[model samples]
Target chain A: MQTKETIVCRCEDITLEEIKSLIDQGYRTIDEIKRVIRAGMGPCQGRTCRMLIAQELAKYYGIPVGEVLMPTFRPTVRPVKLGTFAGGE
Target chain B: MPKVKETEILIVGGGPAGLSAASAAANLGASVLVLERDEKPGGQLIKQTHKFFGSKKQYAGDRGYQIGDLLIEQCGNNPKVEVWTNTTALGIYEDGVVTAEGRAKHLKINPKKIIVATGASEKMITFPNNDLPGIYGAGAVQTLMNVHGIVPGRRVLMIGAGNIGLIVSYQLMQAGVEIAAIIEAAPTIGGYLVHASKIRRAGVPILTSHTITEAYGNESVEGAIICKLDEGWQPVSGSEQDLKVDVICLAVGLSPLTELCFQADCQMKYVSELSGHVPVRNEHLETTRPGLYVAGDVSGVEEASSAMVEGRLAGISAACSLGYGEDIAPKLQAEALAELSELRAGPAGQKTLRGIMNLMDKGGAVC
Candidate 1:
């Protein structure tokens, strides 16, 4: 049982119960989970929360931690302020 | 107008490694520029206050932050070097092109040589209530106290007995924070005995072969459950104990932040001894890509001393690649590699040495 108010993503304040509910509802992978509920898309860019979700999925599938497929590695790994990109071409 | 920035050498990150790279390349007459994401250019060095080990050239036995200042000044003093703070190097692309984002604008950069000195990130261990707000990575805790002067909490439970964990535990004590205990999964302490002894004398108990089973808290960390583990790393049933702690600091480990290297098409190897997936580089720290180099924790997780040496090797090699430093590259590389071997000597560095050997596909000749 997960609490709806239990926060997972601190920047966006997404909750564990929300993530578990998503996983239980067939959003098993991180990609599907991210599309449904934005957990790792915050300022941290999943620095704090990404591996937790992957470990959870690995446990659920009875697979090793290395077997879990991670999300795509994108640039701008560190969060840039919105104004940083709002400039001329 | 957005003008394209040009330089002979582009070094990403300005920590001990990148700064060393800059100083080396600049000394060799290569136009050098460093892109640092932090507001200040010390990287993790700003958070360190303890004396370091290794050679005198690296300023061994001085406080870490002071060394950071020394390196910063050295880089700043170089006529050919320029450092941009608060600038994030996004990634490397074809034809020596890289993108960077500053405070209010994005810029395109083209350089003849590139060094990836992006360093490493703290790794978190899994446990119940691990998502609690009061739980912090070791680096985060250090930055809070050393940089922002904010004490994390009154009492803390440190998980992991590696160098970072041991050093931070002592630093927390210096900051007037109480350490509840240190729980490590390994049978023996993972860091040096010197560091462990300092904290042990401070009346902190380091429980070996133990793991944090759960953390108890409502909204913030209020307590933790630690259990002794068998050789298999499975927790023993009757060994669990709940301890009172306001903060849980995970010093479990660090992993090299090699995603940029991956994006640049550098070959990588998963070596746990090196702290996760690291790029496969040659003796000169040149990765699979020509004119592309790596230094410090981005190449592998190690201390700043060796990182600085590796940075020098990479810098000299990059300089040579661009038709500079021809006279000094050979001697500089040999001396740096020698310094690295001396630092990595003894039982402590055996695993890392092995990992480096495996990655290089050679024996200890590189040392």
Candidate 2:
């Protein structure tokens, strides 16, 4: 696999190589990766990429996929316009 | 302040589980409000064209969509149940106010009890060029071909031999599309033999212990590279096979849609047997937080049959908590529990049974 070109986070356009390099640097967990590369900080809010990242981390750490703690899910589950929340039309 | 609508019971999602819950709660004389994100209330059932298999109570031998229609009709006829379509639940606040956006307006709902039957989302697998066009989740393919009259593509490579994969392959054939092959990473097929037999009889090859290494395409899916896996699940070198296909459909399983459950601070546990992380709830389907209940895939991924039973159990339990149907709720709850156990008695139900037991053992409320 061409890790350099293969995309992992579609929303942020992060690559597999970027994620792997971060893991090697000891930046583990989806939340840490998200803070550094904005992987899960997009509009979809990690709906598509979090699990993939979890699987990658699990493979690297030799742990069960479920043992990888999932990132915290905040409110406004789906994206809503700022105006909608501020009582604007 | 946004318009605040009050109801005795609030059910999130209007699929088979939510609709059954709405009917069950309404039958117990509770005013129920159901919120559905889509334009319609059937959820996944709207795209299923094949006949369902189950006991008669679950509408066995009836087509999937027809069963959906019946459940919709039941909810529609009940005066105490109100369904809001195209409404998405945005958040569950600490103060017990649920916010939703729909129909060009944002509103807040205050209900005495809440039942989350939000269902699950399709799981995705990573490979080269997986983000290219012409790649779709199995549900999206069904929506394209079954819901709309448009065919997805001329030929397709299907990943995962689960029931969704096999059934969608048959549905694609019925829509005049060619299936290149159906592949499963596991050595044995995951779906029912009946569904597998139908596609097998149609001359489509079912390959087990195989997986796609990469999708070949510049812009859209033009082909795929598949290879066999060894005992360790590593792809064998020099065993690669290339196939010509336009569409790649992934039916590789699903994870529960539990964003709201997490937001509400319900106790959650990761049970891989149930697919992914799920809320820890009691036999009555009530989560750790009182008045917040879960049914269907929101609690744990299971069949539509068990989802309906869980919905009914959650519905009656929630209504009974709100001081409705006290005389008959116990009987109905017991019946629902019995039906659920019976549905989980087959060999196929072993994984789900184990998942449920794990949840129970890990401090799920006994009720």
Give residue A63's lDDT in candidate 2 (0 to 100).
98
The docking category that best describes candidate 2 is medium
Task: Please give the distance, in angstroms, between residue B133's alpha carbon in candidate 1 and its true position after superposition.
Answer: 2.8
Top model number, TM-score: 2
**Poorly placed runs, candidate 2 (over 4 Å):** A1-4
- Deviation (Å) of B3 in candidate 2: 3.3
Per-residue lDDT of model 1, residues B1-367, tens digit only: 4778999999999999999999998898899999998889988888899998877898888988998999999998998999999888886776668988876688789998899999988886655677777899988999999989999999999999999999999999999999999989999999999999999998999999999877777778889889999999898999889999999999988878887887787766766688777788888888887788999998889999888998988999899888887987899889998988988897877888999877777322232
Give lDDT tens digits, candidate 2, residues A12-80. Answer: 888788899999999889999999999978776887778889988998999998889888888788778
Q: Stretches of candidate 1 above 4 Å error?
A: A1-39, A49-71, A79-83, B362-367
True contacts kept of 2: 0.48
Give TM-scores for every candidate, taking all chains together and pairing residue i with residue i: 0.90, 0.97
Residue-by-residue lDDT tens digits, candidate 1, A4-88: 2445666566766677778778777887787677788887777666766776787778887546776776676767666666673
